[model samples]
Target: KSQEFLPPDEALEDPAQIAPGDWTLEQRRPWTGYAPPYAPDLNALETQVARFRRGDSLLVVGAFEPQEEEQPETDTRRQSMNPRIVDVRSRRNESRGERQARSNPFGRIQEEPVPFLPEEPEKTAPVQSGLFLIDTETGTHHEVLGEGPRGAFQLLVPNGRYIIGVEAFSPDDKRAWRDRHGLWQDPLVLGLAAVSDLLILKGGGNLPESLDEALPTAMPVTRIRTGESFKAAWELYGLRIGESASVRIGVDRGGEGFIRRLGQFLRVLEPDAPVVMTYEDTGPDVLGTVFRAVELNLPDLEPGEYTLTVEIELSGREPMVIARPIVIVP
Candidate 1:
């Protein structure tokens, strides 16, 4: 029972041993020491069980980009029996470790000095860019974040049901998706946000194109200096000519104010003196969008967080309200 470390080329449990755990100490050499697993090759597969580390709520995904200049030829070729049925192991992956350097005649060279790691990831064509988590149920795209310079991207997301897919690509391939001005080169995204159910952008993403008329501009107003007046334009659909409605637009506490107001509508809560603007469909007889823009010139107030609340009440239908958070600074 006074056995110690055994040398290589000898099994710990020899077939001819007289008894279990009864190896003679003379059989083991004095200088032999423990030997760890040879050149550890760690492999991993993303599974549903592995992804949800945050108590069943998958918060985010951390993705890795491949080496840009990987030469698949240099990798030691591997041969295995081809199974009739293909599975996870048969899928192709060109990603690899550092490039092979010249046999260092002067002993083992440090990995830092040689041109080992590739400049960018995914050598072939740049793979894909941008990280998005689409909700599996509703298909709502959440936390669309761009990659950083060093080929890593991240997004902190709220708890939700999602099918996680995270990947990245090389740097030279940036021009294909982005135009010369570095803007996303997709013309279909031009549709107004309201018309597209927040798909494209409401107007165009700037100031309302028409100031006085019923026109919503792409101009988005999120922050404004105190003592300055900001205006917004909105569009409403399905209205007959001469149909009248009331609109109330004002500032309230920011953040959760939208949810609070929304709940109020469910429970039928109405304030006594809301800043209401009367809107009457004066367009043609056909049902079309009624566009209108508003300018606010309120007296000075303390600078802080607020939500621009817009409530529209039709003749008989339930009121429709939308609130956007804004910040005021001195």
Candidate 2:
């Protein structure tokens, strides 16, 4: 499971677990406004497998090193490939067949070709290729012939994380994609890892922005340049036209917090502070919901991944926060 293989702090129970990273692959949770176009098909699935094989596309998920109690991925292949394996779906089908045979006077049961189901899985026997969603909590899975879970944390995942199980269809992958649509059921195999730290995703600006601004250009702000100036626009709610609110746009280094006290003692160090924009909202209510657009000038920063957070707080209410992960490059 991701919790077991990923770093210890990435676990849900771990207080150090930070925000979810960019999980924009395979439309698991596309924020695009598609009146819902496209359905899972042999072609798309196969193409994805090939992409992962050739290292063209990337998938994002979680995993941590082993904790005290759990041994992640130990003898998993041997367990899944064991010659003897029984499953609930197959047993249910067999039970239904027996009932039908008992109803017939001659007691003859004819074998029927099983229909491919999107969610109702059959048996878990190893195959050359397949796609599955492994529910870590339940230790059960259903075939992903259609829609799958969309989100990083998958908070909807009961008691555990969700692991994507993608078996490669190599050596004529296209044909194999179509051939192994519903046969493979064992999800105890397959994988990928977080490459955000290694690669910068430049083409992810199409997703809807948290701040509602009628943009003049389509800039890929997901990749921010260190020490460059940029502008941000956002709408604030619950504040009257003349009411005061505090607005701030800041970059976070996550758990790698700086030792400010030590830096403060050294004037030469300048007490390392993040690039922050603070706004004094003295009832700056523009159009109904308080709106403000400010040009932000970023300070020199080390090239790495950081979270750009935009927060607005009214005097007596909870502050509305929206953030995006940005990869700072040289």
For each candidate in turn, give its C-alpha RMSD to the true structure in angstroms. Answer: 21.9, 17.6
Give the alpha carbon lDDT tens digit for every residue of 24-43 in model 2.
11222122211101111122
**Clashes per candidate, residues 3 or more apart or on different chains:** 12, 9
Q: Give the Cα lDDT of each candidate.
A: 0.35, 0.33
Model 2 lDDT, full chain set: 0.33
Q: Report how far residue 77 has shifted in candidate 2, in Å.
A: 10
TM-score of 1: 0.38
TM-score of each: 0.38, 0.34
